[model samples]
Target: MTYALTNMRRVLRELRQERPADVPARLWRYAKPKLDVLGEEVLYRARLMGPLAARYRGPGIALMFHEIQSNVDDELRTGCSAGHLRQVIHAVRAAGRDIVTPDEALRRLGDRQSAPFALLTFDDAYADNRLNALPVLQELDVPMTLFVPTGMITREIDAWWLVLRAALRSRSEIALPPMERTFQCPDLASKTAALRQITAWVGTDQARAESLSETLGPLVSDPASLVARYAMDAKDLTQFAQHPLVTIGAHTKTHRFLSQLSDGEVLAEFTSNKNYLEALLGQPVEVLAYPYGTPGACGEREARLAREAGFKAAFTTRPGHLFPDHLKTPHLLPRIDIGYTPQRRSALFSRLSGFQRAMTTRWGAPVAVLD
Candidate 1:
């Protein structure tokens, strides 16, 4: 309790004393992520996300990555090539940062043994992580956590975002149902816009995700092969789990956006997935990464449920450096997402080093982590 109070006071002191510009508190949730991909400057200068602004240097950052595969769209935005994976490991190391697994990250932070460490996490357990990424990570000799969505392995779900990207790229025109609006995909910009629009219509609610998959599947050339080409099957998990550098974790069964589901549904998702992964991996599964982890998708309720579901820790998509206050709320850990296609290595370094997030965050405050 004393330490928690002290941390709160410290955060307030920096917010007022430093008076680092507030881009209308909470806008960072919407703005900080888009600059790297969309490159839009709204509510604050997007370029100001770099070089050094001096704040929010938390214990360590749990850096999130998705597929380490070559792609043209990468709408998931965290997918990168094998070369990109190599570059990230070398770059983080060069910055004098330690790359650790999720368990180590939690231990160090829980004990308040704060240091400039980076926890490399790959979500959705893509097949390319074995085919492409394993070589790169093995060569670099870095430890990382892979969060697997069990449904993907069982062929029960598609990573809808990638499917959307594929659909947009395949045809120049798309006809959206219910609303009956058609999107033109003659270029990248148009395709991206269409992707978001379709997502907004279906991504928020779990009920609509099925509709999205069924609707868009026909658009792709080989819809049935999407999961096969992308997700890691049971065989992959069985072999990969034995690697010294790899730690397997749960990413729910179907990657349903939790906020859209009822409490009972959420609990079921967490427990079932954990049990399934434990059985398959022949090891204890202790960590979790929420699907579509964001303020809109999850909050304290989901965090508490994660704890209830017997997870040692859980992670969110919130972008910030991990701080001591985070110890009070292990289930809601924050992570900085590595760029899908980083334009400048230096600017990315700025983001990875925790400078970019510190600068643009409103009043130098982290996204309201623990109450």
Candidate 2:
């Protein structure tokens, strides 16, 4: 029992330190999250789950979203419908919670006396966020944290995902001579599979541009053009960046997976993007959401780099509710991704509950070493 306890502590420590994992650490990372989610669901079914009561009150949640638009005519789908976004906000309000900015949410971690709240954060700065999500937020009268990729807005980074997605939809077959694999995308399911496989192999947006160009030829032409079409530009954000409803956070410059980069490269990605966004927006960009916020894509090393680069907080796409302990490791914060969930109260409530967050995360909250 003592041995198991020590191993569990070590797994959490590795999450904090980003060291190469042992088998136990690997299992904890992959298994624990699933177990947590299952536990929450099981408890709910058993009627053992309660409301957002005192046990779950101090630190609430940070909801993650991308492309909250509805353009049926457009090939690339929104992560969820704009109407669903309205429902989410309504549900949160019905549960008697406040939706706050990122700063407020992080502040609540330390101020246990603060009210129960949730933070809405949109990643990738999709143009639809402005056109679709923003209006809905306006009608609802709440704020959002927008994580922007400075390079993509500046046309310095290719909106490679947009290009690749379009390519997948238009082309019936995709041939990769280098990998010696040809994907037959005859329908939506096959096309989605092909896109996923290609994206997994392509890895980062930085590498995807080069890999797709080399293997697929001009199949993905002018990623900048795709950016202009799908993503919000610097000019579009010029007005919105200063708005009261929006809080702009850095989403790195090129959207590369920072965990895969060296210390120097990681710092460069954070610092350069921070400097860029600060200069462009004329506001102190104090927070970040690590690009590809997974254990493999971003861990403790990346979070430390973010802190060293002078960000007040950095977020990951890990599942969990915030807790006062998060104050100890501000940069390694976890957020719940609200992907394509239907406009059902049950679905929203399942995600909103503290029991769920507790179960869905490997560790309930981030652990930090005392000085």
TM-scores for every predicted model? 0.81, 0.78
65-181 per-residue lDDT for model 1 (tens digits): 887766634443436787777888887887667888887787777766455688888898888888888887788889989999888889887567767778887888888685467
Please list all clashing residue pairs in model 2, or write none if there are none. 36-359
Clashes of 1: 0
Please estimate how well model 2 matches the true structure, expressed as its whole-model Cα lDDT: 0.73
In angstroms, how far off is 171's CA in candidate 2? 1.3
For each candidate in the order shown, give its overall lDDT on alpha carbons.
0.75, 0.73
**Stretch of 10 with least lDDT, candidate 1:** 36-45
